[model samples]
Target: MMKIRDVGHAIWDRPLGRIVLLLVGGLVIAVTVMLYPPLRDVVQWFLPLGLIIWGGSRVYLYGRNDLLSLISGCLLILGGITRAVFQLIPLNELAGTVANLIPVVAIFSEMFAHHYREQE
Candidate 1:
């Protein structure tokens, strides 16, 4: 008795729509993953990239009077290098990644450094 479009609008415009969308996205990814093999080297890039991003975040705290952050950041950087070595990332590509992250690092650093300072 109800039109399909009316039903879609009722269900898809509510807060529950977000959860339904996530489930649908996951199902699509699962089907696609079965069809296409993941690239190992591409997957390996995430290790160093994530480390660099996280370490850069801690390193930024140095600007806000946290020396411990510098220490932790240095440790994380070392860990990233170790991960890159283990993951077989080429030096050239690693350098390129670091270069690419320069602006991203600055933005994240600034954002997080003052995030707590702003009051709601």
Candidate 2:
């Protein structure tokens, strides 16, 4: 008897492919926000939320063995906490902003990983 193919492992293993797609997605969203003034601030806030949801979706799709999703979730949570803590710090603005976005990027990368894995 043949064993069932484990789709989750197949996709998450291709780290480079996932990273490329994530960079593309981030660029698209960033460019869109830059072009649209009204949506710019809102889009920035929504990115972290979107990343969290994307991570959850990966967990649901890939099951509990999804270490990538778990790590992404942790990074997102830490980023959120750091953002909140640094909100009052007027200095280091760029650092805080990048810190806030790290988890979002991580999750998107993981999601892309999962997506491409399924393709293979």
Candidate 3:
């Protein structure tokens, strides 16, 4: 006999649930971007909060070996440190955007790695 997984409590056990959550998060970000003025001023306010929540959840779910979570945590740390320094240094905003994207690319790269690892 095969075992069945419980749905109500095992939300993270399935990938679809995760996809839905990601989509919802993206929607929230999109809405915030479209509807809000003073977004740059607010981004630092919300991003750190979001980063903490995201990193904590990922650590809880996947432990330290979760590449995505690890990358995110590193990215948050780097961004925070850079932002603090740049406030005093006044580096190019475009450069900051590009620097921040390193983590985004790392995330996608790791996602692809996970996908291929699963296929093996």
Q: Give the alpha-carbon lDDT of every model.
A: 0.63, 0.64, 0.59
Q: Worst 10-residue stretch by lDDT in candidate 3?
A: 1-10
lDDT of 2: 0.64
User: Top lDDT: which candidate number?
Assistant: 2
User: 8-78 in candidate 3: lDDT tens per residue?
Assistant: 33765678987887899888977887788667567655654454454455456554766655655555555
Cα RMSD for candidate 3?
Answer: 7.3
List the candidate 3 regions with Cα displacement exceeding 4 Å.
1-9, 48-78, 83-120
Q: lDDT by residue for model 1 over 6-110, one digit each (tens)?
A: 988887888898689779987886666667658444555766777767777777756356644565565566666566665564557766566445535544544
lDDT (0-100) at residue 119 of candidate 2? Answer: 72
- Poorly placed runs, candidate 1 (over 4 Å): 1-34, 62-64, 89-120
For each candidate, C-alpha RMSD in Å?
10.5, 9.5, 7.3
Residue pairs with clashing backbones, model 1? none
